[model samples]
Target chain A: MVLSERDNHLIAEIQDGLPLSSRPYREIGRRLGLSELQVIERISALQDGGVIKRMGIVVRHHELGYTANAMVVWDVPDDQVDSVGEKLGSQPCVTLCYQRPRKLPEWPYNLFCMIHGRERERVLEHIDSIVASQGLEQLPRKILFSGKRFKQRGAKYR
Target chain B: MDDTDRAIINRLQESFPITDRPYLQAARELGIEEDELIRRLQSMLESKLLSRFGPMYHAERLGGGLSLCAMRVPQHEFERVNEQVNVFPEVAHNYARDHEFNMWFVLATETPERIGSVIREIEQLTGCRVYNMPKEEEFFVGLKLEV
Candidate 1:
């Protein structure tokens, strides 16, 4: 998508995240020499166009007591992946769920879902229930518990 | 955290109004002054309770490509391989995992084709196999870890 000069500038400024102020739009407009309404309008249009996925807070789950995080990968049949992905994604405990291509001989898992909790045991238990209820016991799977976070930040296009 | 702090975290996570006086509106909804709301948010950010507060952009929609890539590095060489992988500007999120595919990261590229080349380059540089797992289908799951 080719963004106009103005829109590009606005995205560059706001990509770090919105300002933490009562009138954040106003502050952003002040910096860009735009009216608060214009800022809001541009953001709304961007979102409507799918350029901006969402406008929300990015919380640190660990600090919020969600220390246990596991990325569960499943090797379900190709035809059934869509249905299985939808079912797993619908689970409240699943933070992320998607379908990825299986790398041939070495790697076979195609469906991926992430679950987060305050404890490792709790996360495991949740995964167990998901596997049982979702009828995924027969599928080959692996649970990779996340270790240290080397880097995590918003995507920077500019 | 106190009730007010918890309230701010809970409310802000779901949605932040897009308005001329967004903070004021949020404060009104939270039953607090605008300045106090902003102050609390700033403090929380400073204390690292919130990693970031802003608009989340969909990279693929914005003419970029993103994928989840993993590597299986020898335990002794994990740190060395990690440094090599992190040096790439496209690497967004990197994490160590306790599996054969020990190192995992997200690569955000300027173009979709760049994903393959990036993986190839990393494989050569790190001397390890790079598994590029680009999402073929995404299910919408509004992930809100309730505090």
Candidate 2:
């Protein structure tokens, strides 16, 4: 859906985040010369169109003591990836789960999942449990811990 | 963080009411005054516990292209390559991971076709092969870091 110029402007204005206020939409409307209802309607439409995934708080997991973060990659057979990925993604320990193209001759892992915990051993144990329970222990896997967080933020649209 | 703060973080992470007075609505549900909820949220945000509080847009669904790209740069050339790669506006979240494929970054472009060109540009600038690993399938895990 092609967004209007006004819609783009509204998105750009609130992309960073909404202001902490009782009536945030109303406050935004005041700034953009829109009615509170109009702002709500526009946002609702955007969400309905799948543009906005959800309006909520983005928590910093590290601050919550989830210091050990690792991106676990697995070389699951292409045929079994869908079922295995769904099962893996359903687990609470696995945060982000997806299938990316495996670069042959170098990168062999296609299925990827992220796990975070208070300690490295704990996170590894969680991964081990998932692999064992899901019958994915046979597959080749690797876990890469995030070393330095250079940047972590929502994709900038503007 | 106290019980109320924990409750706020847990509740707000899953859902934030979209209404005329959202904070008021949420506060009523949380059994706290609207002002208190707002104050607590403000404090959490100021503390950087909450990176942001707003709509989370799916860039791909919104006619934008997104990909998880990685590169393996030599230790000495890591910083220079990182700077060169991050100089592009399309580069979103870049991180240094302890692995052979060390440098990872999320690339977001206006068009799906633009993804390839950006990767090419980055490769030319950094003189490093850019592995454009776009996600083929995504499973919704209801990812929520419950504190």
Candidate 3:
């Protein structure tokens, strides 16, 4: 869906966050020269259109002692990736899971699942459980533990 | 964080209502006073427990672009490459991961074409080959971390 000028402005406003107030919409409406109802309806429209993926609390796993995060990638056969991906993604412990193209020779892994935990051993165990439960024990895979966050911020949508 | 806070975190992770009196409505559902809910939410944001609280956009859905680009600069030139790559505002975040392709960062651009242009610019500026890995399929994306 193409975003109107006002929609863009509205997105720019709430993307950071809705004001922490009793009537947050009213405040946002006030800033954008839109009524509270307009703001609510527009946001609903965006959500329906899939422009806004989700609206809620964004948890910081690192702050919550889930520092031992690992990106587990698997080189599953193309034919079985969809089923395997869904299986991996259905697990509660798996935070983010997606399929990306494999850059042959150097990066052979295609399916990626992000698992986070307070302990490194626990994260590994979770992966082990997923592999065993999903019947993916023999797949070629690699665990990439993220280190040193040099930059982090909300996406710039303007 | 106590039980109430934990409960609030878990509840809110599912969703925050979009309504006139959203806080009141949400607090009612969560079985907490609206004022208390607001206070806890504020406190969490301030304490950095919740990095952010709002709409997470889908760039592709918005007619833009998003991609996870990886690179392998020599150990000696990693920092310099990082600086050059990050100079572009399109680079949302960069992470040093344990792999041959060490420097991994996500690019969120205003247009789909910008992704390639930015990749070209980075390759030219840093002289390091960037492995552009856009998602072929998104199996799932639910970032609900129960505190």
Q: Which candidate is the best by lDDT?
A: 3
Q: List model 1 lDDT by residue over A1-158, tens digit each.
A: 56788998898899887887667888999999999899999988898887987777788888888878999999989999989999999999898899999998888999999899999999999999998998889999999999999988767886
iRMS per model, in Å, is 1.4, 1.3, 1.1
**Model 2 per-residue lDDT tens digits across residues B1-106:** 8999999988887878778989999999999999999999899889998889898888887678999999999999999998888788888888888899999999
> DockQ for each of the predicted structures, in order?
0.78, 0.78, 0.83
Rank by TM-score (best first): 3, 2, 1
The TM-score values for the models, in the order shown, are: 0.95, 0.95, 0.96
**After best superposition, candidate 3 residue B20: deviation in angstroms?**
1.1
**Pairs of residues clashing in candidate 2:** none
Candidate 1 lDDT over residue span B74-128, tens digit each:
9999999999999998899899999988999999998899999999999999899
What's the true lDDT of residue B25 in model 3?
A: 90
Report lDDT (Cα) of residue A18, candidate 3: 84
The residue ranges of model 3 lying beyond 4 angstroms of the native Cα positions read none
Error of 1 at A72 (Å): 0.6
Best-to-worst order by DockQ is 3, 2, 1
Model 2 chain B, poorest ten-residue lDDT window? B138-147
